[model samples]
Target: MISKIIVSVLYFAVVFYLGYKGWQNTRKASDYMLAGRRMNPFVMAMSYGATFISTSAIIGFGGAAGLFGFSLLWLTVANVFIGIFLAMTVFGRRTRRMGLCLNCHTFPELLGRRFDSSFIQGFSGLIIFLFIPVYAAAVLIGISRMLEVSLNIPYDWALIGMTAILAVYVVTGGLKAVMYTDAFQGGIMMVMMIILLYYTYSALGGVTSAHQTLTDMAAMMPEKLQKGGMLGWTQGAKFGTPLWLVIYTTIIYGVGIGVLAQPQLAVRFMTVKSDKQLNRAVLFGGIFIPLMTGVAFIVGALSNAVFTARGGKIAIAQAGGNIDKIIPTYIEQVMPDWFAGLFLLGMFAAAMSTLSSQYHVGGTSLGRDVIERGLFKRVGTSAKASQIGVTVTILATLVWAWVLPESIIARATAFFFGLCAASFLPVYLLGLYWKGITKVAAKVSMVGGFAGSMLWLLFVHEKEAAGLGICQWLTGQPTLVSAATKGSWVWLLQWVDPNVVALPISFLLAVGVSLMTKPMRQEHLEQCWANF
Candidate 1:
């Protein structure tokens, strides 16, 4: 117990020390916002991966793997292909170049400056400020739940304690501290994940043997899962089934493509000095991301085998049927005490790294993009506004963590990711590559995407629609598009991902409005397309 206490204390102290370092170094708004756009390759990549592969990935997505199967491995492939490689080369490089050209700091600021529209920046900032807390709350809930299970602490206290600690550094140190600690936390995550992978394979005799063991246990799947299209823990679900749609479209594709437009992830490109830094970071990000996400998913699926062999209800059931609690409960049972303690800190590292970045981006969006630039158009207010934004973010996160429903981390993460893609992906992609993108088009597209996504979530998508029940109450029906339930065309309204539905509308609106509208001022165009 004393040794565990000492290990935990040292870990916290190092994070605190990095926070102090970040505070000491953040001399101006640029340093605070973008690390003066001079962060090194290693820190940039590590911070990016750390921020991207978060507790939501480990605890939430991992829990989903416990329920779904190795089919979630598709997301790992997507994360690497899109999140790291394509993003760094295709998106990151362009974003960094355009950001430098416009001298923009935040993601919304980049769009606003690109199109020369305060509405674009302001509304985007507002969207981020409002929705990101739900996502941040997901990360907060993930790690806090882990601690609650492992340390025998109350969930509320664990949530509050972690949030308070993160708020101190993030609110004070800004982006520099967040990235500095992110890199440190990223290191902890890598080491612990590696150990976990080793032990998992070793315990089940080897990779092949363990996998064979899992594959042979398909008959053990719960009736609910089997009804929902589950085939096996190793093989995933059947094609075109409801569970297949949920796993593939909502979980995999929703988050997979959505990573490209995530405001928090996108802003990291602007943190580096050059495209060279982004390039160097890619290899590391590619490796780091798989280690974190792949290992989590693999472990989650294998855990079903672990618990089942011991004559239990699978991972989620072992954690009292809360999918989020699967990993924490399993970690305690499966690992030695010292390593389990180390892994707890790894969960902290995962949660804090992602949470700090989310708060920083949310704050910067509110403070810099929306207020200083968009609303007030004032100089020297960036830092103060960001501080206030950070406070609001903390409060919002706490509230959401307190109120969110079960199986939240996976759903919330996907919900926010898909929402961002629906809202920003069209504008961001068009703005970056196409000089034809007009201001009104950008504005219209953003609004359309956001509105479309909300309507779908309310009327069509089952999860939030089911939870909110607004659609049910208004229409006197369980779902808005009940064609399948009632055998009508209205079922078309249900089931499709918001991104699939919203992104296309956003693209068409952007292009249609751009074609009809007068072009942006030539000099604004010159500056935007300049130096690229």
Candidate 2:
């Protein structure tokens, strides 16, 4: 504990120094919001990667890997090739150029300017500001669990302390501080994850032997999971089963595609100076992301084997049935005390980097987009307004962390990602390349997508609907589809992600409505596309 405290203090000292540096450099609202649009490629890349892969990836989804097994690695592949590579190349260039053209400071601002509608910007901002805390709480829960298990801190205290520290740097230093600390945190995460993978494989003998042992434990899977379609640690789940749908649709498909539309991640494109910087950042991001998420999933799956070898129990069993506790419990019990201390710092870096960005984005969305631009007639970022927004976001996140149920990290993260994709992707993507996209279409698509996603979550998605109990309260059933259809074909709809349904719905609304509406003004389109 003494060593852990010392290491934590050293880490915080460096972080605070970086925060002070960012604050010192910030001169105007632009500096606070976009780092003067003069960021280094490496820092931008590392910050983006760190913010993208947080405790949600490490502790929340890592713990999911403990139960779901190697199938989760598909998410890493999608995260790299789709989330990092394609997002930076296909979307980053246009977003950066257009943001420059429109003098936009936030994602919603970019969209609103493109559509020439204040309502689009304000509504998008409101969505982000409201839903972001739920996602932030997922990261909060992850780090709090780490502190609770590894450092023996109370969960509530850990949550409060962590949030308070993050609120300071994020509110005062803004994007500059968030990115600097994120780069530093990203480096820590990479080193720790590499060490963890090496140690895990070494402890299990060799790579080949470790995999073989896990493969041989197929029969050891609980009957309940077997019925749910999980095969084993090494083998994949049975296709189209309940487990398979949850794994593929929600975890892989939802999050994989959803990353493209994340307002927090989207705004990073506007931080760099040029397309060249974005191109360079792509290489760094590609390398950094896999090291963070890939290692977590591998170690998480192998935890089951490690626990079973040491005791006669699996990972979830050792964690007292809470999936969120699996990774933290494994680290505390299995790894050396020194490594445990270092791992805690890595988790802190992971959680703080992501949470800081979330707060910054949420705050900007509320202050700059919703309040200053939407409610008032102001058209630029406001430091004072954003500071207030950050405070409220921190409080909202804390409340969510307090109220959310156990084993909720992965679900919450996926929920926000899916929601963003459904609501924003259609308009953002279409408005970028298509001059025919009208204001009415953009507004209709955004509203339709959001409504569709919520409807599915409330009435169709069994896991969420059952937990929310809204459907149960309204119709006396956990899910409307389940009650109406009986059990015969309920699995097909209940297990599908809201994104699969709502994204297409939103896209169709954008296209169909645009075809019927007048095109955007040629002068506005020319101005918006001037950089290109």
Candidate 3:
């Protein structure tokens, strides 16, 4: 506890100094929002990776790996090849160039300016302001659980305490403070994850020996898992299996591709001075993302060996059936006290880096993009409005943390990621590349995508469907239709990710609506395509 207190205190002091520096350097709104677009590539890369990967990836998905086994590593592959590489290279270059062309500061602002419509900006911001809290709550729950388990802090106190500290820096220092602290936190995360990966392998002997042990234990997998579609602990699920659908579509592909359209991630592109920074940032991101995600997945799967050897149980069993708690419990029980302290602080760093970015983006969406830009004619008073936005965002995170369930980290992360991909990806992609993307098409795509994602989650997806209890309340059944029913034979909606269904619906609408509607104005097209 003494070491824990010391590490936390020292870590916070550095964050405070960075926050103060950001405050000092920020004189104009541009500096507050984008650091005057002069940030170095290293900082941008660290910020992007830090913000993109968080407690949700570590605690939440790590927990998922414990239950689902090593197959979850597919997400790491997607996150690297697509989330990091393609996002930074293909998406980042265009976003930076076009954002500069339009002088757009926010993701929604870029979309709105591209189509010459304030409604698009406001609506998009409204979607973010509304849905992002669930994701933030997932991050909050990650560290809050660690504090609960490790330090014996009350959950409410931990939630409030963490949010208050984050709000201090986020509200005062803005994006500059957020980015600097993110870089620092990202360093902590990388170092700690490396130590964790080493400790995990060493706990089980060595890499080859440890994996062989897990492979030998395949027949010992829980009956529930095999029934749910898992073939073993060391391999992917059988094709046409329920667990296979969940892992491949919902967890892997959903989060992998969904990272492309993240509003918060998109805004980072405009913060850099040029595409050169983005190129360099990719090398950093390529290493950082893989380390963060790859280690989490590996450690989560390997934890089964440690748990069985020590407690005569599986990782999920030791965690009391909640996948979210597996990583925290594993660290506390299996790791040395000193490494545990460092890992705790690392988890804190992960949580803070993510939460600060979420709050900053959510607040900006509400204040600058929605209220100030959408409701008011003037933009000068948005600074104060942004504070209000941050406050609201903090309150929302607390509310969600209170209401959410255990083992929800990965699902919550995917839920938001999928929704954003469905709602924003098509419009964002079309707006960037297609001259035919009209305002009407953009608006319809967003609406269609949002509607499809929500409807499917509520009525179709099993865990969420069962959890909501809406179908039960309305029709006296678990889902809208029983799986045993003939009508449910076309159960793709039940098995596939909502994003898979929703994104295509959204893109087709975008392309079809765009085709039918009048093309963008010549002046709008010329402005958007100026430097492409």
Q: Which numbered prediction scores highest in TM-score against the true structure? A: 2
Clashes of each: 2, 0, 0
Expressed as tens digits, the lDDT of each residue in 82-101 for candidate 1 is 98898899889889999999
* Model 3 agreement with the true structure over 293-394: per-residue lDDT tens digits: 999999999899988878658998899988888999998999999988899989988999999999988988888899877645456766777778888998
lDDT of 1: 0.90
Clashes of 3: 0
Candidates' TM-scores? 0.98, 0.98, 0.97
Backbone clash total for model 2 is: 0
lDDT per residue for candidate 2 within 176-250, as digits (tens), equals: 999999999999999999999999999899899889989999898889999988999889799888888899999
Candidate 1 global TM-score: 0.98
Clashes of 1: 2
Stretches > 4 Å off in candidate 3: 375-378, 483-492
Question: Model 2 clash pairs?
Answer: none
State the lDDT at 102 in candidate 1: 97
Ordered from best to worst lDDT, the candidate numbers read 2, 1, 3
